[model samples]
Target: MNKQVMCEQCHKKVASAWVTKIEGSEVTKFSLCEDCLKAFSLKISINSQNLPLDSYFNCLNDKEFYPERLSNFKMCPKCQLSFADFMQTGLLGCPNCYQFFGQQLRPLLEEMHGSLEYKGKIPVWAPVTYVLNTELKALKNELFSLISQENYEAAALIRDKINTVKEKLTKA
Candidate 1:
């Protein structure tokens, strides 16, 4: 009888598929269940270039791989779509999904994109909002210092400045 093998990442599920790579006679294998496999995207560096895991697993379209029927209540209030649905479909229901599933998606995003924070340049049109955000941040820091020093009057002034900047940002 063949022994049962569980997925290495989420050990609660049985291993259904695997990925293997061979380099210079050294072999590495990763076993995963269907759910884990759907969210198992990764980026690896080869010859100073980053490569996506999808390129290696592209054969799935030619081979046998089907999503399982799973359901969960963890859903986005704005879209009414569950996290399980996202895992199965690999698509978010709405923009609110980024906030709702942030904790779960951060690792997947970091693995696929190399970082969670955007490193690109800001848009020229958004400079006003950007400046307001920077000003609001500085004012909040000043407010904190004033509060720590027991200067409530100065803290109130900084607080009003922060609120004004926030209002401008929201209106922008």
Candidate 2:
């Protein structure tokens, strides 16, 4: 027999959607019913076009979850693409749109990719030091965020990991 999972949000309905967030060594998982998932998706589609998922979920119970309007009037100088156009099509006009709309794109990119920094596979030919440095950089960023959140235990663990990576870099 299969066990059904209840929605974490509504608690009254069986969950149809699951969401997971990973931060450093920490992981968080939650489930949502079909109705609640649809409502949340609709809110993202209709209300906050570029809002971060974290902010939206954090303010789910708030009456004023929507923030001030983004620059609708702003346009990319290279492709003449407006933020509204990008919102509608979900595509940037050109490479220059990255720089032109960087401020507006940051949250959306973070929401979609989890981080502004690219974490794709490194080339096999890449130097060991390069790889170790990249790992150290990411660990340091996580360490800072953990410190800000006052999770000293986790921060200490990350610090040790960072030091280990640094030692590897020195050896390389």
Candidate 3:
């Protein structure tokens, strides 16, 4: 038998949405019922059409929920593209729009891509030193995390791996 999870806010309804936020070394997690989640999303200023959450939270489609006129909406200085226009068109007016609407677009991008940082594919023809350098950087990060958690055994293994990558880089 599975235990039912109650909403953290209302505690009366079953939780339908889970939210997690990680800042630096700290992490926070909570679950919300449909109603509470909808209210929470609204409070966060989630643009309806900008995110796929609108399909799940149908209340966002209601015009009454956002009564402000288009003129009052935030606009990009470079392209003059309003956030409202982006929501309606589902397109950014210019590359500068990313910087202009970074705060609002961040959540949507994170939801879709799972991370803000881009880890693009490296071509097979890329230099061996370049590949080894990337591997060394990732191993160092993992080593730091393991050390922070006091996992010396795992950190030792990562340290060995980093040494091997460094040797390969030196040879290349």
Candidate 4:
């Protein structure tokens, strides 16, 4: 009897017929079996088409993907399907994602950006060893001074800068 190999993604025994090797790239791409290849191929094809992320959500209709990632709520307005529709999922989909599901997406956005409002730019720096502590602390001190002077607009900008610096200093 031949030992069956399973797909890394679906973990089902691939019947050898579905297995195919892809050597076109330098990446080490191989699952012990083939279902993963099919899943991987579909993902690649969908992305290559430049379609929006929401367009291929139907591919997730299989129901085995994300079991319970979200609070397991937030249904799509168009289809009225809840998070339970997919096994595991995140709150990113549709241009109206913020409009349609702001509450649901808060954790996700906070996960990506410390603040939802795009106040301004911040440069990335290496972590650890009191890196931006001085900068952030100084900004905080300056913000307090500005507020004390009753310069409300300037204080707001300084407060935003302080928040941005603190966001950068701390990981999301």
Candidate 5:
């Protein structure tokens, strides 16, 4: 019996099929398992339609993928999933993994998504009170800061603004 060949993309699983392409005189060949093939996001054009592959197979195209080189190595307590595991699988082991590996994941998330915090659009149909409520929260915080700094004049001004906003909300 022949030994099984590991996938070219992810070294963890055995490769089952071969993907090949020829352009001009150059020929390219790669081996991938079904799971990795499914995870690869490279879309194929067939009959003018695009087919989306699995997104789970990240880092398949990057030959130098290595999370072990990080200065701090953190692991999830619940699933024993290491940061390296997340790098390889592109998935967190469990829900608690977020809390456990948040420090490390923050940078990765920011790099991939452009920001760590979700800045989703507010619904167009949202109530006018929603905007007033947000403004009131900010004004209240400013009032607290002014009072703490002993600026009674500014604090009173903010206090009056807060009262006006409250009255408006109550009326609405």
Candidate 6:
């Protein structure tokens, strides 16, 4: 947890010398957190108040029963994510659960169109990937619904199957 670093400019003892990505290697730049970072001229912004460009902010606190704090949501009571908002915009507040929430996102995609995939990993409409994705979407929706309905057995089975598919996806 504890790390020791020196400032690049003054060689002074620093605690968090930033990770400066160089041409090849990720060189740690020993610089003043503020001044050193500016000196490096890396594309970074500090104290950035600009909202997420995904437009998720508009619906941030729109949900009537949303928890006041992130501790409330299973992920974070303060998650404050709006399923309705995500459905309308097809965007997310943060990319945090964008992957993990795939199952939950399926219904929205279905309502929007007959398909769940907005974009493809391989190509616009690769038949194999499309088939596999359709299967994955069905399983994901089933898992989410089962869990919500308290059908533990079905949910567990679907969960295992999803894990298998996820593993295959990772390899691919």
Residue 82, candidate 4: alpha-carbon lDDT: 49
Model 2 Cα lDDT, one tens digit per residue, 21-129: 5666998888887677656643233263766554555675364644334365465766667788889999888899899889889999999877899867887689998
Cα TM-score of candidate 5: 0.31
Query: Which residue segments of model 2 deviate by more than 4 Å?
Result: 1-70, 122-172
lDDT (10s digit) by residue, model 3, range 14-72 = 77667785666998899887788777643233554445444545764457766455222
Model 6 RMSD in angstroms: 18.1
Q: Which prediction has more favorable lDDT, 3 or 4?
A: 3
Question: Which residue pairs clash in candidate 3?
Answer: none
TM-scores, one per candidate: 0.29, 0.32, 0.33, 0.26, 0.31, 0.26
- Model 6, range 18-59, lDDT digits (tens) per residue? 455555565554444434544554443325743342233234
**Candidate 3 at 98: error in angstroms?**
1.2
* Models, CA RMSD each: 16.2, 23.0, 18.8, 18.1, 14.7, 18.1
Name the lDDT value of residue 124 in candidate 3: 63
lDDT for model 1? 0.74
lDDT per residue (tens digit) for residues 1-172 in model 1:
1255779999998776676867779998988877887677666565687767665445335435442222144547666677788888999988888888887788889998788889556554667878788778779889999999999998999888888888898899
By TM-score, highest first, what's the ranking? 3, 2, 5, 1, 6, 4
Please identify model 3 stretches exceeding 4 Å from their true place.
1-72, 122-163, 166-172
2 against 5, candidate with superior lDDT: 2
Q: Which lDDT value does model 3 have at 30?
A: 93
**How accurate locally, in lDDT, is each candidate?**
0.74, 0.77, 0.76, 0.56, 0.75, 0.57
Worst 10 residues of 1 by lDDT: 62-71
1-172 in candidate 4: lDDT tens per residue?
1244455566766533233444566445445443334444332346457554334545554466573453365555544344444325543444544455556657666878876777434445644425467667778788889889998899899888877877776673
List candidate 6 stretches off by more than 4 Å.
1-126
